[model samples]
Target: MSTASAHAPAASVAPPPPGPRTEPLLGNMRALRRAPLDYFLAQVREHGDVVRFWLGPKPVTLVAHPDGVRHVLQDNVRNYNKQTRGFAVVRELLGQGLLTSEGDFWLRQRRLAQPAFHRQRLASFASTMVEAAEELATRLDARCAPGAAFDVAEEFNHLTLSVTSRTLFGSDIGASVSRDIGEALARVQAFANARLTQLLPLPRALPLPSHLRMRRDLDMLDRVVRELIERRRADTGTHHDLLAMLMEARDEDTQERMSDTQLRDEVMTLMVAGHETTASALSWTMVLLSRHPDVRRRLETELAQVLQGRSPTVEDLPKLALTRRIIDESMRLFPPAWISSRAALQDDVIGGYHIPAGSFVLVSPWVTHRHPRLWENPEGFDPDRFLPELERERSRFTYFPFGGGPRQCIGNQFSLMEMVLVLATLVSRLRLDLAPGHPFVPAPAITLRPRPGVWMTASRPRAATPASGTGQ
Candidate 1:
């Protein structure tokens, strides 16, 4: 499964028959630019689950079938490497953190980080989630101001950012810093995907405008992370935070704790992935709720009936089944991690299509989750689609917001708890309704964000009863 074997010069790693080609060098770039998702979907319609094309000059393969996705993510994982488009920028900001590092380095980092997210341990973080949600509720309650409208997306982004900052570094990300980081992150992601440099292959040190801005953004984040690390190092008292747990973690084999640089990378990795994606998910949830009144009302009714009137805890999650269903549906419509890309290390056949070594393979949750053949009313938002009874009849890859297999988001459980608690707490207290005729379009960035922001109105629920809300 080694890359050497996959790309062995002596071996014929290319598919038995390579994918069809278009006119000379134009490739499939123009078609993709016109309508990327539809273009890929059309390929699946014509050529079946596996389709190969060029993104400008680079060769890429798109897989749509469940087995095809599983083969790339699990069985033949070692025959693939992270693709350049996404990882290159991620590596620039995070360095050798779990997301970008490969081989033993990533393995060691994952081992050290996994304990903090263990089932028993994550229970302690529920209170933290509730506390963050309470603050969010308080902010929104104060903002209601009798018939005033607010950007639900912005509000949720702030809420998730608060949770992420407090949970990861035990810091309150102020408005200015949050706005700065958010804007910078957006710019960096946009610039990376623009493929401006694919035509030039500029070095990291190049002094281009985009590069300079990205560097400045990285410097700002680095400064903040280093300061957090220094403060944590200075504290001698025992703290039950992720940072403390990471600091205490040791490699079983090497018995070496993480160094400051390693700590910085890990912290930044969590901050970036933790906040941005969660925020987008929450935002989209609100948008979906606005669009689907019945679902939102049922969610509120469940919160009222189940909790009476209290924040959720770990034990309460199973009972909050409907709320979880709403969140799941939102994710299916707009998964935070929209697309995952990897380069084939060895030529492999997926869905009867031959993929050559070094070719980039894209398994997009956005594309597959909404595939016409795989989903009923694929473009519609419906929570019942995730009901265990119904899901049992569907293909595994038909719904993978957090992905599947080992490479799935390690923070999946934690994130789910966070989202459920936040939603339950907020919806139990406030009624969110979408602005009439407001256009809510999907903007597929690092996460699927609402293009115009989720605009909605918030009103308090008319009830006063003692109810405990816990994470199940």
Candidate 2:
């Protein structure tokens, strides 16, 4: 036996984690459905980091502490698999793509896709990102006249969709196609989130109204993706986009290429993941910036100093520290992947709480990022908290907006770079102010999106303006 295995400590059994007051069988289902974010926050505050509740007969545990999160995501990662309720909904849409696959298949896909996201390769896409942002800025300039109200969330959705299409597939989805794909993706995610909250979800084949709608939306998306894949395959020219690279990727051991179905699944996964999450992040960031003008001033000042009225390049990223921090802080307050779940493949113990085999373990970046014990002013919008010095004092898992461990987001760097460039380019030209009476609130579906959308007015920044005095 290996020395590590020989000396490993034996597992010890412990009682389930403490939970809120519950009724027989039903448990916290009602509360979880009504307001999941508040429910999770309250549970962690009252029941400690590890909290347990029942979804009917099934047991669900929420792990909110950094150490416990580490134990589940890293230390004992092998014992946990993505076979939980949350992933089941994702699997229905994503199939065996990297986001929902497991075991060796996931590893091979990860390896094959890793090279496409290399720093050098991603650097080449910086211009594409900036160009997309510029195109949006020009359109917004024309449509959003001074003091004119518009839905920033909707605009961001379009901007991110265009960027993702160009970067991922080397094609523009255009205005009409972008809108169609955006609407279809929204319906699919809504259906999936509904399934996630149900104690006994109806099967997809049941032909319920919701199920039928989901089927239609899924079919619409599949058709669009399949068409894109077919066009890529038929093209003769060499293309550098992610789709082309993925099409050409071959396994080292077997020397095999991906099948058409595999390519379609991956394209769909990247299309959804690459755009939707980034759009959500940008939408929230714009809302926060509008509400916190002082933070906006700082961000604008940094952009001025770094870019001097020119478009930002990949080389300018290091100098745009505050821009990156704003995105980081925005994600902390409203993570794109707000919640994650893993089912235990073997019995385990985390933070002295027993996790039985087949038990579902939940981790919420929304809760952990705002944990009272972890942050001094957990709910405040303070980008400086992510500055290097303060960031080092916290656990790595404490602010996992992109998740952690081996399965951490493959597009993390790509997303970060994209956000920075887009924010810098747009904020340099126009300042987005919240529209009157918009009533913006977070709708934590599959992704944490803004409910009713974030309505805001865009106008050119006033030259040599004083700080707004809302400094962090």
Candidate 3:
């Protein structure tokens, strides 16, 4: 044992290679500022799979291929951490919760939270998802007008916000808090990605415009969470909702449970993450389906045949094949959580390439999911690509809408169930058409959002007129 201890690997490891470099101190910041996604994509095309760039003094390595990404996200995950500058912004709002925390803290929180979203629990939650979708359909039914454009982004935001709030808390949070949180999150994400924010010498504790708004959002969200927890604690009713489950959970080691502050962070993280990504997914789904009438018609037919004006139940989900296919195709085209990053703690060889210690390794789902080598006709929006046989033919990393590996999204199943129900519920009642002269520009932010918002006109299914036809 003593000899083995002495023979163990050296205490201090060697520093990694100072990856491919360019021009003055900060390389290509000016170009990256003009178009972030395009600039990043350009770097991948020029510098091969692993290219090193700088955000001011910091070195960022972009990994475009699946093999390289798998090394960072899965193979050597222990050597990497979520210590990115952008992740710091999220830590501010969410505290040391699962999304930002490392090691034991993250593991403990994940374990306790995991069971609350288990597949069996999700069956109950599916009802809430369908209920929210039904509300959206009802609203659209009341507002159907010919040739009038509606921002589908805003509508979907409302839908997901409602679903998240009702599920997390046993009651509704209304639209006001939901809107505030959305606006605040937008500011925080912009600040997180901005080069100017990175250049600022001040510490993160000091509030910038974005930081100030984020704090306000955190406070607002905290107040809501606190009140909900207090009310649940005081109530004698037995509720099996997520918040109640969290309240009852106790850590086995210390028998310690979540404190109010901890609860606030977890709830806020779920609300922001849950609402924003789902809304973006729904908006993109609408934009993609609007452009492809045959896909839309097929979706409508499937919903009509399977659901037939009835609200979608968990059992109905498997039968809603086309609806699921449509959403799967939409996600393939525009995954909300596009880019994810990890900071390496030590130099390592990943796929014959040397990755240096302290380098920010980017595993971009946006690039890998659509890589020409992995996907056939990668840019096309084809739902058939996700059909069982075709899916089996596709490469594993070729479709990562909710990501892969252990750090894969906990609410992935919940999100999918919510999306299918929402789409089926909405399409069952209404037909949406893209407004004329509107361009759907993909603006990649915290999620890949539609630049000007997804503008469309919705009419009752029977009153629906195709883009070319007059209302019947």
Clashes of each: 11, 0, 0
TM-score of 1: 0.90
Off by over 4 Å in 3: 1-21, 186-197, 204-211, 462-472
Winning model by lDDT: 2
- Off-target runs (Cα >4 Å) in candidate 2 are 1-12, 143-147, 464-472
- Tell me the tens digit of each residue's lDDT in model 3 across 171-256: 67767876776676666666554523445545657767755765676676677778877888899998878898787888878888
For candidate 1, lDDT tens digit of each residue in 429-451? 88777777578787655567787
Ranking by lDDT: 2, 1, 3
- Which of candidates 2 and 3 reaches a greater TM-score? 2
Q: Which model scores highest in TM-score?
A: 2
Point out the worst 10-residue segment of candidate 3 by lDDT.
463-472
For model 2, the local distance difference test gives: 0.86
TM-score of each: 0.90, 0.95, 0.89
Q: How much is the lDDT of residue 380 in candidate 1?
A: 98
**Clash pairs detected, candidate 3:** none
